[model samples]
Target: MPLSEHEQRMLDQIEQALYAEDPKFANTVRQTNPAVHYKRWIIKASIGFVLGVSLLMAGVIFKQPAISAVGFIIMLSCTLWGLSGWRRVVGGAEGTAAPVEGKQPRAERRGMMNRFEERWRRRQEGDH
Candidate 1:
């Protein structure tokens, strides 16, 4: 239901008053939006991933095994972090059903592998 004009005006007035009373608090509350937070995470992770790539390249050029290893670790961790944030952002935007835990049977999970194995077995028998 839409709010009445009078109610909307009143709500706006209250918001203005609140902002006037403490703009800092209001700004903090506005910045606390989940979407914004997730976006920041994604951006930071992307930067870290780039940095890792540079480190890995530099390590290979300098023949420093330890630096290269550290760079690889940074790249892996950053990719995971960024992907997680991206999933949350996309999921929230789409408002679709989330994946249920422990709902599928083990056979169902292995269905694709089973099909591949069956095909291989048939091919092997036919070769004789």
Candidate 2:
């Protein structure tokens, strides 16, 4: 349900207060894009994958089953982590294509609920 006018006004007041209290934090929150976060996650996963591969190789060379099992687990987890958000990063970038002249951006065109639902659906599909 949509917020009442009074609620909207209250929310606006709260946001303004936040900005006044800490402009830096407000700006950071405003400018934080989900895709950037996902990209960072992908980068971390890549590093982990490399580390896992190295560990696996070391385990094999040293003939240690326990070490090899740990390496395999790390590799699996990293692969899943990298895969999970791969599509969101790509899709989010694609969805952010420049708007046509005199047109609003895609992000501005959709309601917050619509965006949330879309993200939820994407997550469900990704999990499968």
Candidate 3:
């Protein structure tokens, strides 16, 4: 559902306050393109995977089990990171799936936490 005018104004005020408090961070958040960000991570993960492979092979040649184990761990972590980034990029490609203007996922998480806190406060008050 669309936000009411009052909600919109409140959001605008919050945004302006954010900008005033930290213009650099605000601009960084504003200019970020999710696709590009995830693609960069994917690239880094690809590089990490290759490095892990090389490490694994070198460990095998040098007869070091610990090095081999570390390399395997690196490979697994890189695979996970790449897969997660790929999933996010794909999921966010849809226009309808995009969040409302000026609303970040972090804000949704914060709102959920706030609701939980409020409920806890009410429960405590009722117990008194």
* The candidate that achieves the highest TM-score relative to the unseen native structure: 2
Q: Give the alpha carbon lDDT tens digit for every residue of 19-104 in model 2.
A: 99999999999999988999988999999998888889889999998888888899999999987778677665555576568655
Where in model 1 is the C-alpha error above 4 Å? 1-23, 92-128
Pairs that collide, model 3: none
For each candidate in turn, the TM-score is: 0.52, 0.65, 0.64
TM-score of 3: 0.64
Q: Write the per-residue lDDT of candidate 3 for residues 1-128, one digit (tens) a residue.
A: 34569977998999999999999999999898888999999999999999999889989999998889889999999999998899887764442466767555533446444666666777768953
Runs of candidate 2 with Cα error greater than 4 angstroms are 1-8, 92-128
lDDT of 1 by residue, 30-87 (tens): 6776777888989999999999999999999999999999999999999999988997
Between the candidate structures 1 and 2, which one is better when assessed by TM-score?
2
